[model samples]
Target chain A: MGFWKTWFSTPESVSATKSAAFEEHTASTGDPSANSDRIVFSTERDIDLYELEELCDAVGWSRRPLRKVKKAIEHSFLVASMWQVRGNQRRLIGFARATSDHAFNATIWDVVVHPDFQGKGLGKALMKYVLKKLRSEEISNVTLFADPHVVDFYRTMGFMSDPEGIKGMFWYPH
Target chain B: MGFWKTWFSTPESVSATKSAAFEEHTASTGDPSANSDRIVFSTERDIDLYELEELCDAVGWSRRPLRKVKKAIEHSFLVASMWQVRGNQRRLIGFARATSDHAFNATIWDVVVHPDFQGKGLGKALMKYVLKKLRSEEISNVTLFADPHVVDFYRTMGFMSDPEGIKGMFWYPH
Candidate 1:
């Protein structure tokens, strides 16, 4: 199918080169932490779901079934996470994923940072990484569902609620 | 990867059975129309991008690049469309797609109906078809981005805007 041609022709090599460049940039412009406590970010989809669920739990979010979580990750267009690496004991600290049309629009979902990792700029770093990656893939128009309390946090990162007055709506089976 | 096991193990057979049943149901309880003008809905992914683009244009939506549109369709979890059949001629009248986590959450996108087909309950039927398909897969939460004018329309079908005070946010590159 021509669709497969378009899908396979996505600029993966360009994204890989950009990701390497961003890693270098991130390393040079480091966040404050000791060498042993460095935070590393990755776009790898093979994440440890148990660690992700624990991170969610640490942030007071409800538990998602690991089976469903794995399904979500499998179907996602992009999954990014941040980890605190302390002498090979890596801990999932921040997590986010986006489902996209892989073209005109994408919506960010399940963004959470462990409570202990909050206020250390990890959330901002994680979001920046996610947005930059989307940009690398040439996807425009990123959207997200946010809790009311954290609206300002996203605002600082250039996110606006309901741009052009396009409202978000939901349906739940009764 | 265990992830592939989960992805491959999705209940395709169950969904297929439900889709066949739904097709039977629709054929029996369809909207008022002569047999010649019957509207049929399908979950098939191999839609003609040009026809879809024409339908979007007929609804006054800005033209999306067909290449990106194809990429979007390839990545979408589900793509559903409604068509008006007249003997040998099938005209695309309505379209919608969703990107899902395949378990917990799904966001409906690019919902549109040709202007000629509006006000005859085709939009409602199209949405019902999409929601039924999602429910068959056991997706719990469904969300969509709506223009302010259509908010009431979705509300009439059990969609609430920002339920429980959750907000929607967007980010665009400067």
Candidate 2:
């Protein structure tokens, strides 16, 4: 509902949602504490490959060891979309990840907000960032799954019922 | 529909889809002249991890090396609803991985037919394989997002229409 801010200063960062992702070897890390705390707006960063693994671990998304994380970083940058409010480096408040051409469209999967940071409008703000990035790159479509409980939120964001009315699918190799 | 023969024979494969992949790395020597025509499904021992990689490469789905492949295999086995088909020494043909607890089910992904031996009914055969596995598991609810062009094929296979259509979503963290 409000204007979105750019994650990084570089123009390449604007349209490049996960550049290393398509190429395969990626590590994402971000400065979650940049803003530290301001409900209106905050600073965000790219969670490079290595940093992403740590965040995933902190959040218990995947039980991968640091060794594997190290090896994975060498191969493909982990593609994940994340946001930190008030610069909480100790935690990743809201996050998501998807694979895409960036120019065509984006698939937004796993929109999660940290337990302590929920209901503060951080999730929306982060997604707005993602949608804005995708749109800037000429991506007209931004798709995601809304847990039935929160379908209204996504609906407000412009996602509609699929022609089949079925929830989108996701798979975690790990 | 013709009856599909999907047998999950406990063939003793030397390389089982385990939880630890990279640790089980093996050297690869591609059969450059491998009968790129008809792949003779050999025993598990005959098809080392490397051979699996080769077959996956030749087919085009993906062979995420030992590390990543191990996780996928574990996930496949862990989910009470996996219909795996492995061949003799270094010979693996059609495969379809599904995730479900046997009640509400969805196969988020899979169908890796070796490229060299496609168009010979392997993909369809694999789908049949998946169907049989699901039915036997007593899983009546199976869902997935078939490409627009392929929706008809799924309908022909007995998958009903999606009353509420949904598209998958993703957003990579950078």
Q: For all the models shown, what interface RMSD does each have? A: 1.0, 10.5
Give the alpha-carbon lDDT of every model: 0.78, 0.42
**Chain A TM-score for each candidate, in the given order?**
0.80, 0.53
State the lDDT of candidate 2 residue by residue for B88-115, as single tens digits: 3224554445543323333434445666
Over 4 Å off in model 2, which ranges?
A1-36, A39-91, A102-105, A164-174, B1-144, B147-174
Model 2 docking grade? incorrect
Off by over 4 Å in 1: A1-35, B1-35
The superposed Cα distance between candidate 2 and the true structure at residue B137, in angstroms, equals 25
Using all chains and alpha carbons, the TM-scores for the candidates as numbered come to 0.82, 0.39
Q: Write the per-residue lDDT of candidate 1 for residues B1-174, one digit (tens) a residue.
A: 322233235566435534543464356556454534556666667787888988888878898788999998888888887777677677788899998878788899999988877776768878888898898889999999899989999999899999887888889876
Candidate 2 TM-score over all chains jointly: 0.39
Model 2: per-residue Cα lDDT over A14-102, one tens digit each: 44533322111111223354323333222233334455555555556755455543332232211334433344333345556432322
